[model samples]
Target chain A: MYENKRLGLLYCLPFVIGVALFKLFPFAMSFALSFTQFDLIEPPKYIGLENYREMMTTDKLFPKSLGVTLMFVALTVPLRLAAALMVAQVLNFKLKGINFFRSAFYLPSILGGSIAVSILWRFVFAKNGLVNQAMTALGAEPIMWLGDENYSMWTIVTLNVWQFGSSMVIFLAALQNVPTSLYEAAAMDGAGKTTVFFRITVPLITPVIFFNLIMQTVHAFQEFNGPYMVTEGGPLHSTYLLSLYIYDQSFKLFNLGYGTALSWVLFALVATLSAVAFYSSKYWVYYAGEKERS
Target chain B: MMSSLIRSMVAMGVIALALGSTVVSGQELRFSWWGGGERHEAFLKAIKLFEAKNPGVKIKAEYTGFQGYQERLTTQIAGKSEPDIMQVNWAWVSAFSKSGDGFYDLRKSASVMKLNEFTDNDLALGTINGKLNAVPVGFAARMFFWNKGALDKAGVAIPKTWDEMFAAGKALRAKAGTKAYLIDGEGYDMILMSHAYVYQKYGTPYVDPKTGKIAMSAAALKEWASIYKRFQDEHVATPLPLRASLGGVEKPTEQQPDWVAGNWTGNYTWDSVIRLRGSTLPGKGSELDVGDFLTLPGAKNSGVFGRPVHMYAVSKRSKHPEIGAKFIDFMMTDPEAIRVLDLSRGIPSTAIAFKQLLKEDRLRPLEVKAYARIATLNRNNAITPPAAQFEHPRMQKFMREVFEQVGYGKINADEAAKMLNEQGSTILQRL
Candidate 1:
């Protein structure tokens, strides 16, 4: 028993060491860096609370970026969940050549945030790009999709929503697991297909829907690559998400301390949001094995 | 287990042998730069020549486009993993060399690198606090480059001055509708053009370097903003919305499809970028021509923007600083090297090198013509703009923001000026 335990510990060693060195160490360093004034070129000087104060009170971009990030999350999360659920419903049917459609839909999620996709997206949304060309051909005025501040954020949201394959797969799995007997029973009870779906299918998949909701919400809140690559947090900083702001501050501007401070604020935000999500999930999330509470 | 262990041991031995051979064979240096197709091609040729002469001393060239080069270099420097030889920006001198010791002191290798090849004035630009950290490759200036065919096709003559440019804008818009603007009035372009306007009126640096304060008082800034506001209002340049629809202003005009298509007819850019701009036009059938930088009708001073060309500096962390210095010497002075480099960077920094390029016909006809104009401006009595220290991202962004606010009518000229003084003070104070 002791030898078996030792083997198990040995097997886990690499993962523990990897997390300690790459993840946890950097996490702690960034936290410590939040209090300092560092330009990365010069040695970091401790200037307690100055970076935080500057960001909150003086920097206008901070609040603007935060608002932009929250909007992206609110829009993309619900839309992505809806898209994934609708597609997964159809995908769950035992239809012919279904695997090809599944792979085709999954391609974007697998290749999402890559440079190739981002470049392709720019061409699609550019003023003289294919979409605008088609619009002009149809005798309609061409819209500046990525150029206008009003519509630029939607481009990134559309890009994010299109890559809903992971959530769809999870929904598909949960749909398959729902016993056919329950649907038949509801059908025999003089219920129509829509009635059976509402009474039988949905409640049965509440656990999976709740899971996807939380996952997509977190993912949408931290969305960076889609906006960074597509819109460049630009056209008057319209698409400037919080993650992009942090990256620009830390990497582009070399204000690592301020970047760290911004990241910590983001961490608190995401943590609070996730906590709220979990608390709310308890009311709606049904479990397979747990007894129902009166 | 024995077979696998033996295989692992052999692998380790092979790794060690490979590492040992690299160290024993010769010095390996990494040289990094950012440029367009022309520069990358020329630099690759220069590297090939350098490698052939240096024998076992290998130099690896790391190249990228100009975007994010500074940011990447900053991170690499912070990590102490920068290239040995760097194509350093002039503004980076003030940024990285606080004590004048951020880069390797090239003075130590003067004999090998041939420091006497450069004129004193050229040498002075790279010298900081008595430390020769970098050497200027050439001197460059910002000017107006017009596509002659585009304007001629529209029956618009080449604009020789601000009045002509304004008239051209009116005529072109009447004739071509929204087909073209006199130039791209991106935020930075507007700021530079505003400097020329303001400097001609007030013979002083935009910002007082000594006090680290803006030279233009709130009243002066207000006047400047009003003039700038007038320029944009008259539609002499592409407005923000149109420029945005076109593409990023930071990208070379050549890279923009609008520019290639002759929808944007002129550019306000540096001399170094003119060829790249020209190269992008011929394929699209537009004839690139050097036009006169627009001046006020009776302008007091040219207010010509001039600066040292991009320089080569060695990282203090480089294990092979000597080899890096030798490479710089070859790149800057060698006859064969100059033939390969041509005039991709700019006119050569040294007189001898220029004569060589001219004699060998290495400098293209257009380059020679461009150089004559630049030489005339260089010799003119003009107000030197603020030092590169003022080229900080914070200051540049602040300048652009103030101009943008005024241009967009988000705020009035007086408000923009007052806000600039207040916020500019804060920005300077932090630095």
Candidate 2:
């Protein structure tokens, strides 16, 4: 038995070693890097909280990028959650061609980060692109969809929102798991369809909604491809998000230490936000045969 | 069993020694560059020829459009995995090859490379500190290029002077209506012109290198802003929003459809780049006319913007540095290599290559005429070295932002000048 246990340990060694080397080591190194001044070509020199101080004090683009990222999260998280829930509700019915609709809806999320889709998004928003061509055909002036600062972020937001299918799938699974007896009991109580939904369906699915909300919020905060590829953080940086800022600093400018510090701030922000979300879930979330926590 | 183990270890040592010998005997080089269709094809052919001539050596090519080449190259450099050979921009020398230690010093292999082919001034452009880091690819000077088809349709002849160019703007608008533009002068183009004007008037560097200060006065800035504002007010150039719509200032001039259609007709770019600019027009290559460098009537000098267009450098970390330097020498000075390259990478940098190209009649008429005009202006010695920080990315951002603010009416000429002064001082403190 001892020999068998040792054999099992040997079998698990590769994965254990990989996790420690690739993931844990990098995580620790990144945190350490936050306190240094590194320009990649030269060895890192320790500067202590200077990177943080500069980011908070003199870096002009930091606040703008943070604000942009926050705005994207505020806009995309709720919109995507609401969209997914609505589509999932519609998909929960015993309707014809429902699987087709489900797959069709989920396709965008699958194709969202692809280069081909990003190129298509550019063409769809370009000044002389398809949408502008359509406007001209309708006897309206063409709009600078991607060029105008006021509207460029909207193009990226719209592109990101179109990838709501993944959250919807999760919602759909949770909806199907919702008890039919609860609906029957609510109906027998002479509750209308709206009342039944509000009291029965929504209450039971609150936990899934909470899960999707937290996940989508985190994903939206870390979103890079849409703003990076579609609008390119341009038209005077109207859509410059935190991820693009970090990328430009670390990769393009080679300010690796500062970029790492900026990332930690972003990580802290996401963590606090997610923690708040979890704490709030106690008020509204429900689980089967269980009372709310405390 | 112990005897068998000893025998296996002896055999493994033999295999290791054989592998080490093979590694030393063969070399593979990686070369990277950015260009249009012509340069990519010509460069690939050159690589194939180089490989064929040198047995036991191979090369891997990496090329991309200019859009993200700098970012990608910088990333590779940061990762310490940059290619063995690279085509570097003139502005990047100080940033990447500071003191020439950042790249392989080609002077170390002087026997392979004929450095005397290039003039002392040309070599100086590629030198950082006392160490020669790179070889200048070609001589480049900015000149005005116009679409003859559009200018003729607007009943405007090619403008000969700055005043005539302003008049041509009016004539074009009068004949072709408000939508027609005399040129497309974005922030980069306008700021360069602004420096040219100031340099001509004051005979001073626009930005002092030692201090990073805006050497021009507020009155000089006002004069610069006046010309900038006049171009917009008179429809000599398209509006900022319109330029943004066409894909902002960074988009290649050749790729814009408006430029191809002769709507955004004229440009101020390096004379070497005119071939690519004209090739994009509806008339293939015949529509562009190489006009005079926009002049302020007998102002001291022409204020020509002259510099090396491109350069070739070897990686400091490259294992096969000697082989890479030999390849660069062949590309730059080998007559067969030069003929194969043609005018793909602009006119050759060396005097010998230029004479050879001229005698071969390989250059187009437009190129011949453009170089001739540049030659006349070079005699005046008005050309100045671009400010060390002038072409740096961050400084270019600051320069572009000033013009953009002016265009947006967020700040006037005097306020813009003050902002530049304050910002320039702050940036210099860090340097």
Candidate 3:
């Protein structure tokens, strides 16, 4: 048994080493660096809460970026989850060549965070791009999807919602696990499809919904690539999310300490929101065997 | 069981040994740069030639497009794992080498490098704290280039002065319609444009390098911001909203649809990138023509912003600084390397390379014209070498934001100018 344990330890060594070196080390270092002023080329000088003080008082963009990030989260999370659930409902149906549709829907998520896809998204929403061309063909005046402050947020939100395949796949799996007997019983009671979905389907899939909400919320808070590549937080900074601000401070300005401090604030916000979601899940989320166990 | 344990231990040892041996052997040096395709190809050919001539020395080339290059270099520098040689920006000398110890001093390698080939003025541009930190690749100044076809269609001549340019803008709009503007520019261009205008009229730089403070007074700054506001209001340049709507603020003007189609016609840009900027115009590059330097009436200075295009620097952390220095010398002074490099990286700054290229008649006609104009400007001392702090990324962004606020009517010129002086001074002090 000891020999067998040693073999198992050997097998896990590479992964253990990788996680400690790459992930854990950086995680600790970033936390330590938050209290200091460290330009990339120079040694860090301990400043002790000065970075936080500046963020609240001196940094003009911090509050605005936080507000914008909150709005982005509020917009993207629901829209993306709804899109995922809607697509999952249709894809859950056992139709011929259903796998192809599943793959096609998943394609965007695979390519979503890449710079090339972001560039393509920018061109797609551009003034003389395909969407505007189509609008002109249909006798509608072209909307400045990426240009106007009122509409720029929607472009990034739409891009996020369009890449809803991962959440959709998870929802699909949850849907398949829902007992068919519950649906049949609802149908016998003369429940309409809408009633059945609300009564039988939604309750059984609440756990998955709860899971997806936490994930998408966290992801939306930390969104960088979409705003970075697309609008670049412009048109009066309507799309200037906190993640983009953090990146600009850290990488572009080389204010590593202040950026790390901002990152911690973002992490704290995400953790609190996630904890609230987990606590609220007991009321709304129903597991299959949760009642039985109780 | 014992044999199996021994075998596993041996295997782990072998793997560790393999990983440890990954470092390159012998006299190999890493060199990194960022450029467009033509520059990359020319550099690669030159490197190949250098290697053939100097047997057993290997240069590992690392190159990328312009985007994200600075961030990558910064990270490498922080880790103390930078390449032996690097292509650095002129503004980066102070930022990277504040005390003059950040890079390998070229003066130390004067025996290996042909330091005498370059002029003192050119060398001084890269010197920090009396240390020759980098070698200037070439000199570039912002100049006007107009689309002759578009100007002709609008029945307007290239404007030689500020008033004429504004009049021409009005005339072009009247003839060509609202979609047609006199110039297409991003926020940075607007900052430079206003700087040139303000400096020519008021004879003050935006920042006083000697004192390290905001040199433009509140009234001067007000005029600076007001002129940009006027540029937008008068259709002399594209409105901030229109430019933002068209593409990213950082996107090259030449790539904009309106610019390509001849609706957005003129640009005040670096002379170095004239070929790249003009190659995609409507008339297969024939439509482009250099315009006279715009000046205001009663101007005290020309306000032509000129500086080194870029520089080649040897890393102080490099193990083979002498070899890197030698390579830089070859690129700057070798006849064979010069013929291969051509004018891809602008006109060479070194006396030997510049005179040779001109004598060989290898320079393209358009560049020759640009060089001649810049030469004339330099001879008269109309061109001022910009303070390095003026090109700091943060400072540039602050100016752009101030210009943008005025352009968007979010703030008046007085308020914007106050921000420029007050807030801009704070930023400069921190730097």
Candidate 4:
């Protein structure tokens, strides 16, 4: 038993070392760097909370970018979740060639966040692109999907929402785990399809839904590729999320200190939101074997 | 287990010894650059010639297209893993090396490098804080290059003055329909063109390098903003929104379909890029012509944006600094190397290479014309070279935003002017 334990420890050492070097070390260094004025060329100078104070007081893009990020997360999370749930429901049906349909739906998610896909998204939403051609064929005036500031965010939001396969897969698994006898009983008692879905299917899948809501919201907050590659946070910076702002400041502008500070704030925001989700889960999410608190 | 560990240790030692022997055998220098196919081919040939001339000194070439080159260089520099030699931009010298220590001081390698081959003005552009950070490859200035085919289709000639250009823009659109514009550019291009117009009329640069402050008053800035607006309003230039719809605002004009189709007729771009613009256009490049530097009446300056095309700098972290310097000298002054490079990197800065290329009649017609025009403008004291601060990315972004706001009608000319004067000063002061 002791030999087995020693071998297990030996096997885990590489992973432990990797996490320490790559993940934990950078995490700690970034936290420390948030207080310094590091430009990657010169040595970092400690300036206390000046970075955070500037973000609040004088950094004009901070508030604007934060608002954009929140809007992006709010718009992306629910729409993506709703899309995943609906698609998962349809895909869960006993239909012919369902596996092919499943793979096709999941394809975008596999290629979604790539730079190439983002470039393709730009062309598809371009003035004389496929979307506009379709509109023209339907005898409608083409919309400036990427050019108009009001419509630009929607283009990226639609891109994010379109890649709902991962969340749908999770939803599909949860739906499969749901008891078939419950649906049969509801059906015999004259429960309508919509009634059975809401009363049985939705309630039972609440745990997975909650899990997905938290995951998707966190993922949405950190979205960089779609906006960075597609719109470049442009058309008057309507799509300039905080992640893009951080990247521009850190890499492009070389304001590593301020970028790190902004990153910490983003981390805190995601953490607080996730904590709130976990705290509120008991109200809506039901596990199979949990006792009633009351 | 102990025997296996000993065997592994012996194998690792053998590998390390092999690597050590290879390093001792010869000096390897890594050289990086960003360019097109022709430039890359020319550079590769030059590198091969240099390697042949210098035995036991191997040159490794790393080349990429223009996109993301700066970002990659930045990360590499920060990590201390940059190439031994790099092709740097003039604007990047100050950003990367403020006190003139970012790159290896070329002045230290004066014995190895033929620094005297370049003119003082050319060398001064690459020097900062009494330290020669890099050597200028060539000089470039923004000039008008028009598509004669497109202009003829619209029944217009290349305009020589500001008012004539505006009239031409309107007339061309009237003749060629709404899809046609006399000029096509991104926001940054429009801002620079507007700066030239304002500078010619007012004799003030956007940023005064002497004091490092915003030089234009609110009224002058308002005129600058107004010129940009008028260009779009008169159908002389494409609006920001419309350009944004055509791929992206960041897309180069040469890549646009309108440019290929000759709907967007012309651009005010750098002389070095004239080859790219001319080559990308239709009809065997005969349709392209370099226009006269357009000026405004009663103007004091040409407002020609003149700078180095690019520069070669040895990295501070390079292990083979002498080899790197020698290679740079060969590229600049060697006759065979110059012949191989030809006019790919614009007109050569060195007198030897320039005379060699000129005597060989290797200079392209349009590029030569643009260079001659810029030289004339410079000789007559008609051009005021923009301060290096004007090319700062942050400053460029701010200027682009202000003009974009004016173009989108989100703000009036006066408001944009106020922002340029007030906010622009604040940003410049910080830098």
Best by DockQ: 3
Q: Please tell me what DockQ candidate 3 reaches.
A: 0.64
Clashes of 1: 0
Please give the lDDT score for candidate 2: 0.81
Provide the interface RMSD of candidate 3 in angstroms, 1 decimal place.
1.7
Name the regions of candidate 3 deviating beyond 4 angstroms: A292-294, B1-23
lDDT of 3: 0.87
lDDT at A287 for candidate 3? 78
What CAPRI class is candidate 4?
A: medium
RMSD of each: 2.9, 3.5, 1.9, 2.3
Candidate 4 ranges beyond 4 A from true positions:
A1-7, B1-26, B359-361
Q: Rank the candidates by lDDT, best first.
A: 4, 3, 2, 1
lDDT of 2 by residue, B79-175 (tens): 7999999999887877786567999988998888889998787788878777778888987888788898888876789987778888998988888
- Extract clashing residue pairs from model 4: none
TM-score of 4: 0.95
Stretches of candidate 2 above 4 Å error?
A136-141, A184-197, A292-294, B1-25, B185-187, B209-213, B222-226
lDDT of 1 by residue, B205-303 (tens): 567756667777666677788877776677677666555554443545677776777877888777776777777775432387778777776666787
Residues A1-294 of candidate 3: C-alpha lDDT, one tens digit per residue = 998888788788889999999999999999999999988888999999999999999988899899899999999999999999999999999999999999999999999988898899889988878888999999999988777888889888888888899999999999999888988888899999999889888988998999999999988998988998889997788899989888878877778899999999999999999999998888788877665535
Clashing pairs in 1: none
Candidate 2 vs candidate 4: which has greater lDDT?
4
Model 2 clashing residue pairs (backbone): none
lDDT computed for candidate 1 = 0.80
